[model samples]
Target: MRSVVGGVLSVVVVVAVVACSSPREPLPGLTASATVTTAQTPTPSPTIDYSDAELGIVFEDDQSLTGDEAEVYHWVATLETEYWRTLTTNTVSPKLSSIASPEIHVRMQQMADKNASIEGGHIGGVFRVQVRDVVVEGESARAVACLDYAGATFSDPNGSYTPEEAGFGGISRQELTLARVADKTWIVLTRTAAGEC
Candidate 1:
């Protein structure tokens, strides 16, 4: 369903995901990057400094994000929001408006609908999601997320209560990898998800 609340357009993102059209070439094997390095000293986890500027977007405490982890987390959150918006509206092509492919967007939307159907569904609401437990190594990071996803009775695509019936609430795991694109920013080269609850 589609509707407008205040001015924000809200859509119920499905709980499913699509496989990548091009599966990444697996490293020679699962252990390709896990090879033990004698000279490698483990980097200590950054002290939780929730006051970091980058954390302002979603996190307010050091418990979930820190350092480069914060920046990458925020970046992913921004991308996810934009991607969901485009996917729900179906006004813009996913390939042009998002870092993901149109196929993936289509698949994810379907999956979300299925998941919501099983969970009683929703019509519409506001959403706030953030990455949690980010572990950064060099330019790569992995983190789980806590999604504060909900829908308000605003824009209903089919003029039905579908969005409100399926008020948002789900927790999914996400993996992210980043490469430096500039002195202060990095580009998310890959994001993959497996299984959701």
Candidate 2:
């Protein structure tokens, strides 16, 4: 009788194990399903469009500007703004390189390096930038601007004057040659002091 009971128990255990391991099928009128979802990438925001009037820039025919001409104008304005901001803050902003061409970027980097060397720190005064003219031809263009250095100063950390303070002079004219790269972005190819400031 004990052997018979053991055999019955073994049979019950085998049946339970088989049922648990077997694949399940949905009953009629019932269904099993799984859902998969994918994430979408967000689109970048458009760049802000700035006008000559907004930037305090004066030009001969500011009223009428072709699309390309306007783009070049904005590029130059943005570049100058970033340059002065860097000077005043005494910090190199990545935004400067974005608007500058390869050569201009290198020059700006050098300036930033120099600014980093000020032992006691310095204060940069505000200056005015007047856009004289901008001429665009295809992917290349030239922009002339007058940078007024009046009231600008770089004093030493000890509140004493330094020779570098004399470096800031009067208004100077700057000429910039720009090229529209393959990415359709304008970059300053070269920058030079055209005349006295």
Candidate 3:
């Protein structure tokens, strides 16, 4: 009987000690440490401006025109009207007009016509260019552009298709040399098609 009482008392004491030693639960707002959860808002995307003269050509968004239809037209127009016009008016040599045994006006018109069929429609792709090298001499500067052309469609709306029809379609990798005509104004004097430069 004494042994049983001692055993019972020992078990009671052990249970009390353990219960007292256990860590107490934290009060409502009081905690040992804090886990601060942060709520982050995304930053808005920037709007690209292509009309800045200082950012001309170089400021073009090379990726936006890919999936957007209207953007593609605007992109092509910027290249043909803004960039190509500068080249034809300021840097194109008279010799190039004779290279095809044709007048420069005729060749340019032909090019414009071919470009017309590709732009402003869903049958083509857009491209972006990066200026890789530039050599400035006197009033002229030769600049090279590394182009990335994609989503190009070579077929005409009239059911005619020609990938070889002089800038018709397909991503043709080449280097174009442009010269500076006026202060901060440059133009492409020569362009070698399919010539990787």
- Score each candidate by Cα lDDT: 0.49, 0.68, 0.44
lDDT by residue (tens digit), candidate 1, 64-166:
4556776766656555555445434443434432444345456656755554444333323344455566666786655565544343232333444434344
TM-score for candidate 2, residues paired by index? 0.60
After superposing candidate 1 on the true structure, give the runs of residues whose Cα lies further than 4 Å from its correct spot: 1-66, 92-124, 152-169
**True-vs-predicted CA distance for residue 24, candidate 2, Å:** 93
Clashing pairs in 3: 125-151
Evaluated at residue 193, the lDDT of candidate 3 is 57
In model 3, which runs have C-alpha deviations exceeding 4 angstroms?
1-106, 114-123, 157-171
Across residues 1-197, which tens digit of lDDT does each residue of candidate 2 receive?
99999999999999999989968787897767766798889865554443244323322223244467667777776787777766756676688777776677777777877877877666555556766467988889998867766645566666744334556566678898889985457887777887764
* Candidate closer to the true structure by lDDT (higher is better), 2 or 3: 2
Candidate 3 lDDT, tens digit per residue, 1-89?
99999999999999999988968787898878878999899865554544333322333334332223223223333333343442323
Error of 1 at 114 (Å): 14
- The C-alpha stretches of model 2 lying farther than 4 A from their native spots are 1-66, 160-164, 182-184
